[model samples]
Target: MADTALPGTRVKVPFAGQAVDGFVLARIAESEHPGRLQPLRRAVSAEPVLAPEIAELVGDVAARYAGTRSDVLRLAVPARHATTEKADSVPAGTVPPPDLAAWSTYEGSAALAGLAAGESPRLVWTVGPGDDGIELLADAAVATASAGRGALVCLPDVRDVARLDKALVQRLGKGRHVVLTADAGPAKRYAAFLAVARGAVRIVIGTRAAAFAPVHDLGLVAIWDDGDDLYAEPRAPYPHTREVLLLRAQRAETAVLLAAHARSVEAEYLVRSAWATSVALPRDEVRRRAAVSVTGDSDLDLARDPRARSSRLPKEVFEVLREALTVGPVLVQTPRAGYATRLACESCRTPASCPACHGPLRIGAAQAPPSCTWCGTVATGWSCPECGGRGLRAPVLGDRRTAEELGRAFPSIPVQTSSAERIIDRVRARPGIVVATPGAEPPAEGGYAAVVLLDTWLLLARSDLRAEEEALRRWLNAAALVGSTADRPGRVVAVGDPARGSLQALVRWDPAGFAQREIAERQEAHLPPASRVATLTGPAELLEGALAVLQLPAGAEVLGPVEVGDGSEEQRYVVRVPRTAGAQLSAALVALQASRSARKEQHLRVDVDPVTLG
Candidate 1:
């Protein structure tokens, strides 16, 4: 390979994802022995994107995942920053609403209270979904740092950071704080990095990548929604934000507050092992123990029929939704993305494939032949070749379609779709036929006339170990829109078998208990918040060949020849390496590259603490 040198100077460090040339500032004397030893050259950064501590975290993540540190660093640092404030150290703490109203009663309040008071060094809390617990944790984080300490609050995605930012703005004021997210531009991010490294901003609100945020005398590290898949970085050094924060908390000797609607099994391990203490709401308080009807697979069968919506949507759902809309506003929740779930041909029981690439085809026509968006190949015109029958595969549902159906169902009421596209800024403040995606569900136009979870199975069908946890989170999101978000009691009616969903949590308005049971199952399965599991992906043949030479620790076992990608029959392999052997197994597999074994074999992907088992 051509000698890689960054532009500007001889110091070539991995910048963004690619290696670019830059001037290196420091070079120590040589080690006793070495290979690939290159002299350090200098570059003009004018400023560095990552602080030393932050860079170290990337390296730690790499070692943990058996992947390159460069990729992990990319996810943590923003592509750019809007603006960076110079270091201006200031202390701040939790500010309750003027009324002390319900502000002091935020779920994570007690956990933060004990830590700031120096009574607890580490606290783990599992809250039910939609408790505004992240806001509460933000309150505690501010308090911890305000008491002469530093704080880092890392969330799963930029969306969450934005939510927390608004809350922080209202609670902590706009000035004297730093917000770091991937969405921001570069020069600005580097400047923000400088602020944290130099002790300018004592409080940092960032995405999973921000687990590396540098703050001296850190008193707290909080991870919101530990169960969120968004927190699991998709790139190399596939580190989970929760693990990163736990490590940071341990290193800094600061208290960590896992303020999640549901506790993760990995986090439960921390509590069960005495690594951290668990604070949660009672089971009966956070779950819906009441008897409720369920609409599931049976209901979906009816909706999928092309004839079902001919006149005005599925009769049953239409009637239920119609009746609910008359009461106030009806909440309809699909998956998080508007049109992510896809449909397949009913006859073959196989998802329609792209004519050329065979990639999954999305529905584009009403009763029209399905054409692969990727290849433009049209399958048999609405007929199943295998069965000689005309039927639809699974029809992907999104808020757009749901809203359209609702409009048709209730012709009189106005229906609005709420998602990233049509964001409801203050969910507690609206009333309408709010058809929403999971996280963006708008508050009830008057506490939804009724909540209809359009695709209940989608939540349960996720490949992640925390599928149930996520389902609860979505249930809570829908329930919140129906119930009072600002502490007023309310009611919610879900579409599926009340038994299948967190109807108990809704009826009882308890998210804490769901989190508890969810954590227990994860712990039992040796999932994260329990024992760690790593996923290695790439070309199947390459992975298998690599696996052949992989030497895991004695205590660890390989669990699969699990299917990965479909590049080729053996293009992918899912190798489950136990946490104890994670580092060692990954290192060993990587070591096979001494001769560049993977170069011609397959691409290598390592996911540390993977959320999705599939």
Candidate 2:
């Protein structure tokens, strides 16, 4: 690393979703980015900042995300702790695992063995409710350590860290490893960073930011769920943690494992590209544990009204919930977080529109007039834009709505609702109507008596390209929270159309197979996995000129001029490319960087895997 602690030079200061002006801290002798590079304006960390190899990882992630390098570094290093101890002068040798018996006997035993062999780290994807051997994953650091390598376990949140930390402490002994996360406060987190930096603590477990942990002789990098939006670090140079892990593993020649119950298309791409292999349990094991029933099956989509919810909580769901509650605690999963997620006209099925501008109406503050989320124009008498109709419906349901219905249906039982406002432990401790937003599900007390997968259509209804993959992830996370011991598996039921690809994966408990099929679609459409994609939407006039000037190399394909929104809006244009053509396309985009005309008239969103591509 150079003496980046230098005096003066324009430095790109990294911030969340924004950039700021700053100057260089110093220069380096041998830095990662040798060109277009300046020193740090000031020391963000009191200790050794992000490690050089980790920086390399960040660089790779930035390249893939098409984001700025500084922003990637910020995601990689959320904070720096105060432990400034230089690494110890220990000689090279193997360290015995504290819990060898448990390590050798973990679930996904075959997959764990692949990891133990130091295979280039690959993400391990799975489905069902979450709490399966998280501690065992944390403990793998001990096994990898015994094999003379360092391991870094990056989790999504503090709750996960605490959950996994307890497992590590109980099984491997407390203080045997180090825990790192942003919530730990600067001083403590920094101390943990240095502990690993100096080799005092070899096994490093932390939240998203810990992807930058500096551990020499690194061997494995594992991310729980590669699809969670939380892992995407919402910053200027937004980079996904999974991408960073893949890059870090490659540069360090370390093993990578992405662990999740449901597999993502990206994870499947790794397997298809020979970057990683799939690690899963037997079909019968998962089936016998949890008998899944998908509503909307042609055979049986019995709505209580028999009319079908199409997207709402069908009446039959209430029946299932009633029975499941009698057996034990039940979970109801919804798409939105708040009390009322949407506002619709009663006369027409179309979404309500603003009077001033023909934009969709949003719900919030009953006193406030209905306004367009897109144009922010106050709407007059509620009406639908497509048909001067007076009715609109929230195709997607919210946790509050689901909870309200459950409370009415199951009047005798104690009911609880968990959203962003309520903490995880509160929901985890309940036994009643545990209505939760996707990914917000708390650990179930006695494993959910039944987990009603509501609003399955909202996930499928998204307009992004990877909609199916993302929905499956949300479904799987809810399922993971509803698991039981080997003797008895939990019961999980879906309340919407199970005819979609997501249900196929959930019902059969075959995420890998589902992902394989989805990737094939993307590949056939010349989309992600097979091809890199970018989405741009705004105004028609501006997009017209932008599209005319954009250039691509021989291998790249620019397929859109396709408009988003309604036909009248003409607000979308999509770009497609083979993965190998990224550099050329990236350079072209840099050259055609939105001109004044384009910026003023239309907006552009550069997304690699648009989760909704409807």
Candidate 3:
């Protein structure tokens, strides 16, 4: 059995009198057990799915996130497909040298050259407005492939993967690249995985899980829009895609590109720490391309139009939208997606709540009955708990509601809606209005004539630490889709307080500056990126037990055992440590988890550097 099943080989072994599937990590010359070891049940396959480098990455990620190795392996590898594994390997195609002219506009074009020459260059790239970031990534992959090395590009979702897939096909031709997304189904996903493992394809692109693609002789790992919440794994350990790719890059000495329209504090930290180089267009170039303005930026302007503060669409916003619609499609970005996501009493101004579960009530459609946002319980004849008034009013307007209003205002023009329920990938570059929620804004053929950001205050009002940063990111993502030129700069109008730092940043097209300021503020507050944080959530006694056993590193601070969830049994504890002591903190938490596991104790969920702390 030892001779037949080598390290990384899949095998079935006897565990507690039951046959369980497992992977061989290593072979030892002798066994330390006092009793004779049980014989192997059978070998599942001869193919070693877990490549050595990928196995090392799994271990590193597990240690970093304080999770078990098996859990990380589940994310790094795909389930086996017997027929796919037994099929003939596809031959690699010749990749033509990539056109680097597109990268010449940025100062970091040298990094791409270095990558093509087998040099590792870490870069934090800020894509310019109206630029096809997918094409840029494909160019990098082509450069890597031309040098006989592999490249991996991880996108936030299937939409992005599809865009990149199309770009790669146009550049690298067929069979030169493979996409590994869960949407491809089990058989096709397994086949794509096998193709990479067998060295059939040197270029790979997919969503989050593709960060672990075993591309042979890897030279580049590029991640797009790392700030998107989709990049954060919801399962145990909750490893973020950006962190995972950084770990892989460090271990394999591969070039890594973190590209996005808006900068994240984590990515900014990479540049500040000298771990990566910043790549962005010149300020003059940015000014020449993006024409942005904020409503209520000046007292004089607000005094001229007093209703701008209370009205959803101010007079100035309407003028901009009206003029832009004559030339091309106009994008109207709303914060929410439904008809009315939140409701309140009309007479008393008290929030409406579901009587069944005490959750906030919402309306999903026009004139629809109120329903609980939490449990989906319909509320009939519901009255406000704080007041006797039964009438309800919508204070927040979602995409659907905004679309309905815009359709009436512009009765002659067409109004399209995009949200989670229905997404429009692309619209014609004709005159129309496209109403969409954040992250759901579809691109136009050439580009939108203008983008109107509605309800900016709703995003800034979130009870989360990254609220401001997230708001800027969403705004920038939408604004970047507008077309621009030196003679006719793209227009972006944001309805919010002009003095707000995020709004000011959007007006100036300075995401990097905003991120720098954000990092400085976080440093003063001792928040993430400046320090390390871990959250432990479970039952009260379980959390207390885990905290007591943890050998916390010096300078570590434990913030809470705060009550959470629907009942008192559950609690949450926040542990923080200086950046220098992050490894020690992770190690201690890992030991605590191991101790609990050995004693058959209930495990607590652990999330390190979580996206939010609400």
Candidate 4:
């Protein structure tokens, strides 16, 4: 035992062709094993890569996510770099912290003020639509820094990180903070890691991976837009940003803040349970920031107005766009990117597919011919398999087609398109229309004069659990680009069913109320955010065997043994348990995973609290 290294320490061990770097899990006594074990080649790091508390956190996450220690460790620590060994000194700073009074103006921000003053407080706050997330985050960081402790703020993607970093550096000074993201050059990423590990930076801000950075004397951990799918890691043993921060807050006894314009059901769950205080603006403030309205197409006058319902620009929407464009650039939010993303046969009403490859047909632009989305073959000779129909119709329109329609309706007006392939971060200060897909909307120079959210039905039609919530988020995010306030008020027009809960919420400018309703509905339905759910995927036999052996917590239910993936192999099942029994459910799954690993059984992937149930 004396000859072996302790857990959390780095060591070199024999591998496929040569010695490879590894972490020592435990000390094994020579007497315990009769076989002659390979000696440790050498120690890799002078310091423990996993601190005692962080090591404990790794195990906790493994149990919670049904993941292995190594999976969590992959994000906890970065690969070793020689350049990071140089000693980095803490830079001096003394910028005036953000006005605490400004933050306290929100309905329940007093608790957050306490958090900045070194008191442990947990809060779920929603800034009104169009409010800058970076501003709130900077305020929290400044307060934490003033109290002489570090703060960690995580955003969903690099674009968000860039926005927050610019604000943090201006408020906290360049040297007092460090930026961490997966996109950073190896040396730059490791340098930031060294800064945090060495206690040289008090403010750590980055994307998903930054949630696990080893900061010293952590006083606050904050996450922005917890609902974004970008926060959910795509790799094995996926750990969501919101859950990770929650765990860290509990383990470190630090202040926690989950802020977003459109709150998630899970965040609202915390508020309901009284685990966190709710911070939000009053109704008047919300109305002041976001003056939203619904323009439904169901109106008889609207119904009688156009020949092409799918691409026709509503007269009301056109008037709004005309007015908005006269003042500044207007934004048109579309759900898809291509010209006509979905096609169907006019004769039979069946979905149109390419005859050559049976793939879905799409048009690149209004003038382009129908082509297969999968095989990229032009469907010039294609016929509908269902009715031998020669003509195809577009059931759902897209951004390019919408832009083309708008450009024709308002001739002499410049038009631009932004989507997956081409992304313009900022639109120029011109009286024109910038058509964009969701999440690809560009920032207008001074703020958009108005935003028209087109085709709202497409987003709400998704089968996922978060369809409505996500749709409102996308709409509000774009609407937020319009300047808000009494003096320079901005407007947003949603083209859809006005009776829908989400649309009504947007019109009333009440995201929190909407979220509360959503949470209540989920509770009634026994769905996630109200309950705990886990998904298991593997070979059919292995899945069944493991399911039969699992000691599920009381009241746990298994939903499916549904087939997934190619018919050659693979299937999936979902398990649900009451929120009160979440720990028990995870523990049982962890035990099953460990057993499978021990027996060298065929692999199965288990994910607890997955972002999507389907």
- In model 4, the clashing pairs are none
- Predicted candidate 1 versus true structure: per-residue lDDT over 1-614, tens digit per residue: 11332221134455446667443323345666666654433342334445555566666766666666556656655443324433443433343322223344344445556655644467776554335665676677666655667778888767678877887777768755687776666665666666776676777888865677777677788888776778777666667788888766665577778766555556666776777776665554443322123443344544664444232234456666655544456667777454433656665676655556876766553455556666767766544445656666556676766676667756777777778776775433233577788878654334454566666656777776567766877676566444433433233445444555355554455455565666667556655544556566665566777677766666665667666555455433445445565667667655655435335654566565567776
Better structure of 1 and 4 per TM-score: 4
Give the C-alpha lDDT of model 1: 0.60
Q: Count the backbone clashes (under 3 Å) in each candidate.
A: 49, 55, 0, 0
Q: By TM-score, how accurate is candidate 3?
A: 0.95
Find the candidate with the highest lDDT and give its number.
3
Q: Candidate 2 residues 250-284, lDDT tens each? A: 77778777777778788888888877766666666
lDDT of model 4 at residue 84? 69
lDDT of each: 0.60, 0.66, 0.89, 0.82
Query: What would the C-alpha RMSD of candidate 1 be, to one decimal place?
Result: 6.5
Best candidate (score: TM-score): 3
Q: Which residue runs does candidate 2 get wrong by more than 4 Å? A: 1-50, 62-71, 74-108, 114-133, 173-176, 179-186, 296-316, 343-397, 426-431, 485-488, 534-551, 560-575, 583-614
Give the RMSD in angstroms, all C-alphas superposed, for model 4.
Answer: 3.1
lDDT of 3 at 605: 89
Whichever of 1 and 3 has more TM-score, that candidate is: 3
lDDT of 1 at 251: 57
lDDT rank, highest first? 3, 4, 2, 1
Model 1: weakest 10-residue lDDT segment is 1-10
Give me the runs in candidate 4 sitting further than 4 Å from their true place: 1-9, 13-20, 24-39, 87-95, 100-105, 300-312, 386-388, 485-488, 565-568
